[model samples]
Target: MSGEPLKKAQESAAESPRALRDLIGYHLKRASAWDLHNANAALEAAGVRTVPMSVLLTITEKPGISSAEICRILRMQRANIVPVLAELEARGLFLREADPDDNRIQRLFPTAKGREEAQRMLGLISAHEERMLAGLTMAERDELRRMLAIIWREDGEG
Candidate 1:
């Protein structure tokens, strides 16, 4: 393997600087990108992208949730979630109905088909999660999840 040393050198050169690697945000972003990429690819066959998948899951879990509530809970901008919601609506994944308490607020609800698709998506998500966390022990995975929850809440509050 004459090229092995050269490949090693090239990879070493491409490694992130220590300062970047030390940053929590950098690690979070890298991990987020990796997970999102894998999830998107795995769910593509279901005609669901990452954002839509998230929206669908949230809607399924919290039926009659408003778009604003979703944005707040998910830390997504209204503008960004709008297009995703529109796409989901167009695809018959969910429907917006006027809230009984406040007609001005539109509540989100998954259609019957959407509920079925959400179940399928959950299975796909579980597979993707397993693949992503394959190297980690069960304890490690649980700890990582706990750490992430702490970070998520702290970051949102800040």
Candidate 2:
């Protein structure tokens, strides 16, 4: 390539606006990545990752919630949830029992240990989120969360 063409290419690349940063989707994904990294680091002491943290919180909040219900609420597939349930159960954090009304349906119940872990994880998560949004004022953070909820509040239209 000619030096002139190479120079023009580099100049254009350098001068181009960061349009991706202006995009809502781009910022959401990037922020999510940063949250994941920080949350994982903070939760490492608990031996739990983000998904498990969510699942544990859910289970603790709604005891007797079924794995299927968890799938719907978490927007996760059964295949992904099953392993997490297994891991939590093996750790004695929670247990599944056959539903009284339907023998086939298994309900999740967080044990005493699971509730304690959930409380601890929540504290860690709260700290991590506060740190992540430390630059934002309280009102801005509240508004950001409210706006984010509205974006995901409804089912997608076909």
Q: Which candidate is the best by lDDT?
A: 2
Instruction: State residue 30's C-alpha deviation in candidate 1, in Å.
Output: 2.3
Q: Residue by residue across 1-158, what tens digits does model 2's lDDT show? A: 33554575456545646785456796677678879999999999899999998999999999999999999999999999988998889889998899999999999999999999999999999999987776667887889999898888777722
- Per-residue lDDT of 1-158 in model 1, one digit per residue for the tens? 12554475346545989787668798678778878889999998888887788889999999999999999888899999988998888989888899998899999999998898898988998999997776667988899998888866853475
True lDDT of residue 148, candidate 1: 85
**C-alpha lDDT of all candidate models, in order:** 0.85, 0.87
The alpha-carbon lDDT assigned to residue 31 of candidate 1 equals 73
In model 2, where do residues sit more than 4 Å from their true spots? 1-17, 156-158
Per-model TM values vs. the true structure: 0.82, 0.85
Q: Total clashes, candidate 2?
A: 0
In every candidate, how many clashes are there? 0, 0
